[model samples]
Target: MAEVATGTTMAERRASVDLTDRRALLACQPDDPAVLAEAHRLKETALLDFGVRDSVVTSWLYAKCHHHIPTTAVETAAVVATGDGGCLLLYNPQFFVDIGLAGVRFVLFHEARHLMHRHLYVEPELRADPVFHLAAEVSINHVAMVRLASGGLPTRAVPDGTGGTVREPVGVDPHEIHRRYAEDLSGQGRKPLSYQDFVDTDLVVYRELKRMHTPLVLPIGLCIHADHVGGDIGELPTDGETVGRIVGEVLAEAIRAALRGNRIARDEVLNLVDRSEGGGDRLTRMWGTLGAVALRGETPRTRRVQWWKRWLADTLASKLREGERLVYPKKQGAVLLALGHDPMLSRRGRERTKVVLVALDTSGSMSNEVVDWITSLVGQTDGVESHWLSFDGVVMPFVPGERVYGGGGTNFQNVVDYAEGRLTIDGEPFEVQPDAVIMVTDGYAPRVSPAQPDRWIWLITDGGDDWPEHHNPPMACHRVITGER
Candidate 1:
């Protein structure tokens, strides 16, 4: 901040600002006492003949209260005067954040640049000329930021609305950024610009922003609420922390995906070694491994299988003929043979197989894309009963007649309870057993387990966190990824 690089003196720079020209350019001058005072203070900072104030620059700022801009603020918009009539500056950070900083700055600069060039006074060049002017404004701001970041501001020419001599940032393309921003805006049902054009350039900004710890929580919250309850679920609560909580839930789900292996990692038992209460006995909680798996989204491929041991366990129903009593397939071959046979239809007095309880994750992260697919997996056969349980933080029995909805938290244990209940000998004595308990989830489920159901198939989309990894599941557990068999 001390050394004036490029050997440029402040006076020389101030001289180029042309306060008189700027005041003359703007038809109006600041009238508000507070703003006027600030402007005067800024101008007076030019002390010892070493001046400051970069080109009577017009800036934009916005004020919001009760979801509406104050009348006083709008009235203040009429009062910008930089001595010389230059550009009228409006400060609107909130608007820019919503519309994208680069875009908003472009519009502000475009209008300011117009005033600087006296385009406003001339007969309106087409009613829509303002649009082009706005674009130019965006271009100017973009060029300025890039120049500043690259430490080449003084030498670089700003991009004009039309092509100009402005040098694109070194190793930081902007086309893609612009295009993506445009597309994102458009996808929200707004006017869109070409996103692919400067995608490379935009990534630089995105990376930098990410490095700076920019808050992505709000946008993620907006997306979740939009996808879950509907985007128009009233204005998002002003409390950003609540929004962050919502995002945390979503991000947690994404984390689950990274921990487990891809779909092929399915149909295996989780290793609940860590969660076991010493002595390597039964696990105190299955969620420890599941949580670890969910958190291991970026785990290396070689180590994924090492996290758990998978075995195709005994099948639910053994080969039963008419009057042939249930002979639990204790051997792996019997289990495999039973699995090979269709459990739905009865052949010559064969009893239909008990229903398999299918649990589905309905977290906000489990977008409809995954839900619709899981729904399709529900068996429609009259003999083979299938049940669906959709859950987030908690679980509930998905009654056959009810439509699947409401996703936020995920608790796989409740789903297991429902499946176990059906498998019990009777819903009363709990002796019946299910053929298999299939669970499809993003895998951030809470840690809990009911009585072990027969073959447990965990078809995870995102890797699951909190899946037990101590004692391996007694049955075969396969983790099929989305769109996989």
Candidate 2:
């Protein structure tokens, strides 16, 4: 029953969260100690089956910590907590009756999500609604629909320990169970049922003699990918139009909750929000890159910009210094793929070759989010000429795999100095100069650099300070305000 300290760093908090009470989740059953132990083991197997994360499972367990499970098979299942501790749930037996083992597992996880995440805390009366029980029913029926659609189920029923026939559980195929579970919640079956129907069925089971499953959307392929890829794929892919709609609906609900002045944390909303709102692909790429970077640094936002610029710079520098040429590797792919090409020329060869140089400023004012993201982008690609420049008083192109160090000053002139000998953008044979230069900074640096007649400069910053009008000539600059300032 040890809880994590609230103010610790994210890494520390994550480690603590992962170590949450497995025994507590097991403490729910009032059965014999052996049976309860078996239940705890079964829950672990179920979490694995459902591809739930330790953090998420821990959170669930903590929420469920306050309430004990129903004592008997015939007793009505009800959630007993409120505000931060509340959840609306019911144990339905039909899912268990109809779909078998998967039904039981699906409901358990679904109900756990409600109690553990405190989904029922949103309202006061939901716990009393018959619909509470239906949560699991709809969830498992959805599983049935999906399983039935994608060929067929393998084991419909298993042996009841007592020679009596017990329903085969749905938990065995949690991924598939979640998928169909979502479909059922969406009311996609032949005789369509409302959300109320799903809930009411659970009520009937509680009132009558019967069944199991949790109600929640399991977007198609998500369960498969989550189970295989782990819960941290960053962003979930849009699974066609149907699943996309469900994701959208889920996002809308989250937003509505936020707008209602709920105290839900921003990151939690972000975690649950639709992956497509901003740039899903961009966010995923950025997250993957950040995850690779070391945890020490500034926050996510600052590190993202810094890392992106660094990636652009280092990658560009590596490609250029090696004498590699950027080319269209294949017309099918949209991005330019730089490759080492022969400098030897035929009569038909063109004399001019384009090169790109990128520079990033890592200053005390910059955030960690930007830095980590930049590092990640650097790691994902090849053949691009990238240069990472960290400046306070001076600018230097970053070496591959080097830790960035800078404090208190920045000067663009070093960029000019660094490129002085080898590369001249003006078609000078003296050196192979960059065709374009990209500069990333917080605009806290000296603005002017020595003149380069043919260089293109793209500047990205927070835009607090004005650009010096006396900047070097023959330079066309694009200024990007990242909104951080």
Maximum-TM-score candidate? 1
Please list the residue runs of candidate 1 whose C-alpha ends up more than 4 Å from where it truly belongs after superposition.
Answer: 1-348, 367-382, 399-403, 421-433, 466-471, 483-485
Error of 2 at 481 (Å): 6.1
List lDDT for all candidates, in order: 0.36, 0.40
| The best candidate in terms of lDDT | 2
Model 1 Cα shift for residue 133 (angstroms): 99
Clashes of 1: 84
Write one digit per residue (lDDT tens) for candidate 1, span 124-182.
23212222222232344355455334332112234567876553322112343344455
TM-score of 2: 0.25
lDDT (10s digit) by residue, model 2, range 1-485: 01111122212112111111223322334545554445445444544555422234434544454433322221212233322323322222322333434433544544454453343343324322333323333444444435334323323444678887753333223334333444544454333233334334333323321222333322221111111111232222222343545665564444333322234633455553334346765664544343221222224442443333433454344433434334443432322122222232223333344455556776634455555554555454444444555666766556645777876667667666666663333343225566556556655655565455345344445543424323445343333324353
Where is model 2 poorest over a 10-residue stretch in terms of lDDT?
Answer: 221-230
